[model samples]
Target chain A: MKHNFGAGPGILPQEVLKQAAAGVLDFNGIGLSILEISHRSPEFEGVLNEAVKLVKEELGVPEGYSVLFLQGGASTQFAMVPYNLLPEGGKAAYVESGVWANKALKEAKYFGDVEVIATAKDKNFTYIPKDFTVPADAAYLHLTSNNTIYGTQLQEFPASPIPVVCDMSSDIFSRKVNVADFGLIYAGAQKNMGPAGTTLVIVKDELLGKADRKIPSMFNYQAQIDGGSMYNTPPVFAIYVSMLTLRWLKAKGGVEAIQKENEEKARVLYEEIDRNPLFKGVCVPEDRSHMNVCFLVENPEHEKPFLKFAEERGIEGIKGHRSAGGFRASIYNALPITSVYVLVEAMQEFAEKNK
Target chain B: MKHNFGAGPGILPQEVLKQAAAGVLDFNGIGLSILEISHRSPEFEGVLNEAVKLVKEELGVPEGYSVLFLQGGASTQFAMVPYNLLPEGGKAAYVESGVWANKALKEAKYFGDVEVIATAKDKNFTYIPKDFTVPADAAYLHLTSNNTIYGTQLQEFPASPIPVVCDMSSDIFSRKVNVADFGLIYAGAQKNMGPAGTTLVIVKDELLGKADRKIPSMFNYQAQIDGGSMYNTPPVFAIYVSMLTLRWLKAKGGVEAIQKENEEKARVLYEEIDRNPLFKGVCVPEDRSHMNVCFLVENPEHEKPFLKFAEERGIEGIKGHRSAGGFRASIYNALPITSVYVLVEAMQEFAEKNK
Candidate 1:
């Protein structure tokens, strides 16, 4: 069997995928396919509420936070954040790290003034910006927790009096986090959750309804929370699959256990890259992402050959994103540490042959 | 087997559901579940393009129209319509037919002035408003083709000088339309298409980017079209199921054939409701929906007994919406004539025993 390393729509726990597949065929002994069931039905209502409860329990979410399963990915969240928080004549702070961070800042521009607190773009986004201060009067501070493309992650977080917003699209549920430390956290479910259709949002209740602009009902967190994310027909199948994965995570000892396993997977891959004569890790050591480990061949001429070598040995989607063109092996929470060892073996064989 | 007749998330063809369920397990012979694959991959890109092509071909969509599979539901489209087409200081006329039409108007109010040209609420939304003149200066005349809650439908569409926008959430793909006549058409994919999670949007290319306000990237039609609906990771499972359903429709002789069968089903059911001594049709006869067939027991006391009887015979979700309570059997595109016959038989038996 091949190992998958594609970013965003990354790996899922095998058992969760199987259960989700079975659910699509027949949900909870119901003769109808999950895809064909009514969202307003009592069966689906239970599924929705249970999924929300699982996220809250797993995250150890403090009181007064609304957990919602919304559609439209983190990219949509980029614009929606400002639309609901950055009112007219207001200013928000954004940390420009990767391409996604820049995109978020660009969309935020339409709603209000965006202050560039820090940016790592000057160095091809190879490292996270460390020394920067968020404006005291800013509405909220926005940052991407992990830069998927460039293999960089924020090693140090800035403490701000203003509400903090984070796009944890690539790194959510992989580790233990203080849920109350941020005002809002958003993640597209494709990465570590289950699939691509659902998006997770955990927001502090008091921080909403303060925008000066008229927000669309779907984009308004207050509206969604009031409606229990059923203001309109939700992405039910996606949410159902997510619920299954959340259950799997709980069965495997939650985020703290997953975090330890994820660290070992990253350590093995990063160690192999450092030891191999023909390869080197892409990002600075201090800021490397455990979820997505990116590396490159020492000699540019060896890049194609090394990629081919990895591909022939049952590895897929190991090719790096075009913007950052070396190689990326996304070892997400569900991807086992043994796959990392296999990938490391491939790299060592390639290095020996080339030498 | 029980036949489903829920309003929003209605029935889908059994074969389509089976194939879609299989897709959740394995896609295009690939071991990876469709949910586990990357949206940017060639496999999914083909699926998205083919789905769009099938929609255009099936609907006979005009050359300048753009088809987009978006996340969020038609409720999102309600606000997005005005944000993309209705400029600041401009007005748009609306035919307030039922609950959905009024909701559309409520969202549009946030962007510009909304003119309710006519409303059917005077009669508790039991009939379509026949005499209404859309203003020539209005940005667009918006209407909901089928009213799910109140069982009313617009039989006679107004020929307006202004542009026309339609919310075809419940009726899309069930009948052929002159695609070029309307500037935009939006539908939540749960009814006639496939499942929830994806919303289909068909907009005339030239009608976009004319709004005065800065549109959010996710809601902006032009940006979404340019991105080929990959502005962010799409609802892959939803779009894939919709594609399968669209293909099934084409295989079964497209919308013309489906509409013919739909008419016969409605005729058969409406005839039973009229001929039976204990039952009566709900909406005004002329504007009764061919898709959703609504009826009521002549004696209100008979309602509970008939519903319980139907339930015992494996007919679920036949109860009317809470707002208009009698009975609503939604015979959407995928529901069969045989199912309608079964429902008719149930009604006749109830009438025989009750009388």
Candidate 2:
């Protein structure tokens, strides 16, 4: 009965792991353990104020947006979105498209004059770079909407007049978009939210004090949005299991009904890896990746007995990305349409006993 | 029953929260939810290889020390320990003492020629500055062993012909020193390891390629010690609840028996805030802080009825740090000596019912 498809600390939501394992045994009863409380205590300020008002009511996030939650991941917002809004020696732009968008354009060229402009690194990034430009007084363009190790995504985005910033860690929320077309987004709560030491961010309250250096008040996103992310000592049980995986993504029908169950679990595992003749997928099926599908196999020696015949039929983490080898799966937003139907019936029983 | 005196994301260890709430419901059984697996799976590489071999067999840490498990806390190692050990314009030598050792000496003075050399900010820092001089061909001396907002504690660290580094975010492992007398240490796993997106660090393998520049492969501590902290995608359920609080600190006897139960829970709350005349204490009883004690309130209107009588006796995070306000507690290492005897019997029944 196990079937995770691991990518970015992957799968979650068995009632957000039985209410994050009953809030580490107590929490709501407040007998401690939500890793023993206190992110400025009103019981973790009601779990970071109802997980930032359930991400501004499940991502409508407008009315002068701010969010925050922070703690280095999404590679510390690629040097905190160019150290809190570039400014000094300005010029921004970046795009690249893999390995965390060229490691956030090499941490925003160690603080300014960035400008890669656009690149899928000659397609080894597999795709996602059309009509680049965007530099009329550039101080913010950056990208990486999705590229968990070259699976590639961005499906839409592009039309910018400056101010954008993204990194959406691994295809944020996995669907509904337009958080007012960005002015900084961030993500990293270990994919689809709930693990790695939390990182969210959001921002757009006037793109924050226009950076003239001296940032580090914990990488100032206006000092963590004026101390609501409680200035410091956060990462309280990874934002309380990312507020029970955003209240199990607003009781299963929020980000537009979980983007129709994440495009039907990436169209049933990319139509059984494009009609499996021993499989094939690696990006470019219109920049493949509804959350890391990646593939390859026409007999790479049945990749270690098709990952031990899908790990003896429980079908776990699919394995791929020792710089991209043979399988990947991933299906993020709390992956479970019976775990992509047990990974498309274990890739149709490993292509009928190895074709 | 809810007495989490919030120092770090404070307090943990009830058999490491019942084996981290049974590994978020089935990690060992592999039914999944150690936050949905796969940090390069061998079941998260046997949970990051037995949490870096139980921090080198409970901090004996020999053989070219490495450890790592990072994510920007310890304020991103105050600019990744002078961007991976200084150099261009090199210098080093800090020690300022209070607010995060003066924010790691203002981020190692933006990367070079630092030298605060020594300072308790002329006693306003309340103590711990003693005899200075740590220069001798500098490039690494820094300190801050335990000052979670000025409660002070260096209790013996100064024999540096350079290369020391410390931070030990809020007195690491409560007590028991000489992890090969420092050459990098860090701590921020929300005080005494286990939450807040994991920080740890450790270091010292010939301080790795003496940093000339270009870190940022997640602030490269030698690329998280040559990718053993998985070089990226770490912070997996805060390193599996910091390997279930280092296996409940090696079945409760490691770190020299939790340094005699953290010196009998900081000597029964600094002997009831020094025989209470309505509380006092804040450092300098030979540099206090066995792990953040900090106190105050001989009658400044009994500091708002001793923090609303320790938050109506449930005794929560004891307030202080409105830049040194009036009460800190913190007593980390999973805090219980019966929650510092329920915060020194709720500060002696709020000083005998407010004197």
Candidate 3:
């Protein structure tokens, strides 16, 4: 069996993929592809409305929350959230965890006063900063739930005096989180959900309408909530596939069961990296990402041969980002335990051959 | 036999959809869903490279013109164009044709001196404004190639001393045009390309580093163009499906042949509406939209019955926008000639029964 470990457009459930393949040509035998249907029609409305409800029920979102399926991925929400909530001269505190965290913070600066409360920049973002107090006067405290590139994760969120906004693009639905803990949560539907193009935004209704500026209708929370995410043509096929993936998540016992599987997968790979003298995990042990495990060899010479060996053995996407070179294995919610076993076995074999 | 006439995210060619469905599950038998593949990988890089090449070849874009497949719809570019090119105090001339035109103008007002050179509001936008000169000092003269809601199109683009920036969301690739004539052209992918979530931006390479302020990374044209649209996680599946559609466009004799077919399809439907006394076209004949043909019933009492009759005959998505409150037959690129025939036949039966 082939092992896939690419990040963020990462692994998806096999059953979800199968159902998505079938639905593209004929959705429930409607004689029209899902891509061809009108978003306003009852057929598509049913799909969208159910997906919204599932997000609420599965995450235990409190009542009066508005779930939006938007375009431009999590990157768009970096600007949209601030545009909708930041009044003129308003300030929001942002924690810089990784590349995405820094990008989000930069976008917010365009609208209002944005304060960087804490940053892991000194350590090359290898770990999440801790014990930082959020400003009480800030509108919201923003954090990255998981960083895919540097293999860092915020293990437990710190208490915030203000509302919290999270960019949970990488680790959303991988673990059970109290959705009510934050005022706003946004995720791109790529890693744990379905595909790119669709972003899932869950916002508390009360946090909206504070923006004094004239927010673009497309970026406005009220526009999306009132229009039911169909204010304009939505990313139809991506959303349909996401609905299927959500169903697969439910069928497999949701976040609780998946978290156990995810933990075990990470354990096997991390243990192999730790035991093998030739390889070293990049991130601090306390902050290694459960989703993406970044590692490197002691000698640069072993990197190319190791990558080729892994590829020959049906392992793919082992290369790391150019900025932080080495290797990465992305074990998302849908990655099976068997794939992780294959990766671990390959690492063991490589160590034996080198010795 | 099924006909889908939903405006955007509307009908796509069946062959393209079928191939896309197969790829969604296991992209070329790579054992991974296309959604999970990394954009940086050679596999996805091939997809992007080929897609850009096809767009350039099929659209007849001259050398030095860059093509970018970005996230967010054309609406995002309304602000991005001004943010990137409009120097702090620069002025841009805009033609107010319809809703989208006005929206773009309003967004630009936030940045610089935005001049509304002409407006079709005097004629209720049923016809395109004529006899207006674009200012020489303006950064760019902006226009909407086709008004999706008003059912009007610019048969001939306005001559301008400055570069032309167009929002070609509804009617791109419907006809052959000189790509070098415009400074920049952008379109949301849903209407005629594939699905929502991906926006196509084609701009001259020389049009860079003009904005005085530091633009956000996602909105920065140079950052995206330099990164090859992979500066962040792109809308993968929407783009993959677009590649398939673009491939189909190439195999079916490119945009030139499709344009002929599109014109014929629009002619058939419009002729039938003109001949029938029970129906009257909404826009003036000189300014009718070949993409969206909007028309009203001769008598208000017959509207409900005709709509019901069309629904019963398996003719769908012909209902007009809430503001118009009539029927609009959207004859996009992938809409079959037979579907237009189906709509024409339905209109004939409704007229005979109620006339």
Candidate 4:
């Protein structure tokens, strides 16, 4: 079996894939493919409802928040967040942790004044900037919870006076976060949740309708909330697969239990990276992401050979991003501990040969 | 043997569904689920490239046009069209043919001045408004090619001095269109193309970057074209299924062949509707939609029983929209003429029982 370590559109539980495939043929034994049913049909309404309920239960989401399974990925949310929250001429604070954060801030600039409270760009985003001040005058403070490109994560959320809009696209549901702490949380489903089409948004109800901008119906969170996420023809198949994935997550003891497994997966893999004489971790020890572990070979020449060596042993998508030329084994929530062990073994064997 | 008449997320070709299911489990022998693979991966890039190429080939898109597979459906395009084409303080002329066209024009108001040059609302959208003049000063004239809810379609497109933007959500590839006649044509894939998550946009490349407003990257057609519709992680599974459906279409002799089949399907169903003493067509004869055939019971009491009668024969989703208050058989591109025969047979049986 191939061990997938792709970052974003990463690994999913095998059972989820099985069920999703089954649904594509005949959904819930209804003699209809899930892709063929109307969004307004009771069958699909049930799927969407159950998915939302699972999200609430899995995250222990407090009331007064709306959970939406919307089309477009986190990239859409980058603009939508500001469109709904930032008023004309209002300033929004941003903490640039990595490339994704930089993109988010750039989108926010189109809507209003943007204040870069902290940035790690000077050091090529190797570490998450910790000493950042969130201005109360700003409409909201945006943060990237996990950096997929550089393998950096905010270990602790910064306490902010204003509402916090966090992009947790890479690490959502891999660990627990108090739902009450943030005004808005959006994540593309490709990472820990499900697939690439749908985005999961948990927005504080009171945080909307304050921007005073003429928001389009699709981009308006309030409109989506009012319509129960069926404001228009939603990404039906994407939502269905996401619902199945979430069901799998729920069956496996939810986020809390998955967190322990994810931590162990990252720990064992990172431990091997440090212990191996030929390998080295990329990010600072304190900020290295549990979701994506970035590392490199001591001798740059070993990179190509090590990648091929890992691929031979059925390891896939371990090659790092182009911006950061190294290996990034994204051990997302669905990645089994066995896959990590296999990668570690491959690394150890490769180091032995190289030395 | 289910005859899916659902108005989107409508029926897909059975073969396409099977292929999509297989891809969900293991895409192209890659041993990784399509949902789990990276969108940037060569495998997925191939799928996306083929999808674009198929669209260009099927639609006979010209050199100046770009085919985009975007998320957020037609509703998002309602805003994006105006955001990209209509400049601030400019006016967009709209032919308010149906509810969808009305909604599209409403969204345009958020960006600039809107002129409702023609509307068939007085007749409850039972006919397409034909006598509308396109103002030369208007940025663009928007029209809905097929009205799904009302079962009305523009049999002939209006001659426009300005660029014409059309929403073909319900009837995109059901027939052939002169691509050069329109500036932009968009369709939610759930109808004639593939499934719900992705939308197909064929836009004139020269028409973009004309609006003097700050269009967000996700909504900006220029940015999407620049990124090759990979401005962000696209709806991968949706696009994959769409490509498969398009491939199926091409193998069936492309749009020209499908259009003939669609014409036959509409003709047989409408003939049965008109001949049956208990049923009556909803829209004006010349304006009836080929994609969605809406009709009503002559005696109002027959409506529920007819729906139940159809359902018993394994005919699903034939229930008309609530606003229309009748029955609608959405014979989209994927629907076989045999399914139309079944529905017609059911109608004949129902009328015989009533008589």
Give candidate 1 regions above 4 Å deviation. none
Error of 3 at B92 (Å): 3.2
lDDT of each: 0.89, 0.81, 0.87, 0.93
Q: Candidate 2 i-RMS (Å)?
A: 7.2
Q: Per-residue CA lDDT of candidate 1, range A250-281, in tens?
A: 99999989999999998888988898888898
Q: Label model 4 with its docking quality class.
A: high
User: For this target, which candidate reaches the highest TM-score against the unseen true structure?
Assistant: 4
Query: Highest DockQ, which number?
Result: 4
For model 3 chain B, give the 10-residue run with minimal summed lDDT. Answer: B210-219
Per-residue accuracy of model 3 over B205-283 as CA lDDT, tens digit each: 8887876787767778888998899877888888888899999989989989999998999899999999999999998
- Tell me the tens digit of each residue's lDDT in model 2 across B1-355: 5677777777777787777888888888768777777677778788888988998888889888888887767877887888888887888888888878887888777777888878888777889886888878888888887787767788888888878988887778777888888888988887787877678989888987777786556677777788787766777777888887888888898788997888889888898889988888977898887888888987798888778877787877878877888888787877778878877887888788777
lDDT of 1 at B191: 94
What ranking of all candidate models by DockQ puts the best one first? 4, 1, 3, 2
Clashing residue pairs for model 1: none
Which 10-residue window of candidate 2 chain A scores lowest in summed lDDT?
A35-44
Better of 1 and 2 by DockQ: 1
lDDT of 2 at B212: 70
State which candidate has the highest lDDT: 4
The candidate 3 chain A region of ten consecutive residues with least summed lDDT is A210-219
List the candidates ranked by TM-score, beginning with the highest. 4, 1, 3, 2
lDDT per residue (tens digit) for residues B12-83 in model 4: 999999999999889989899999999999999999999999998998898999999999999999999999
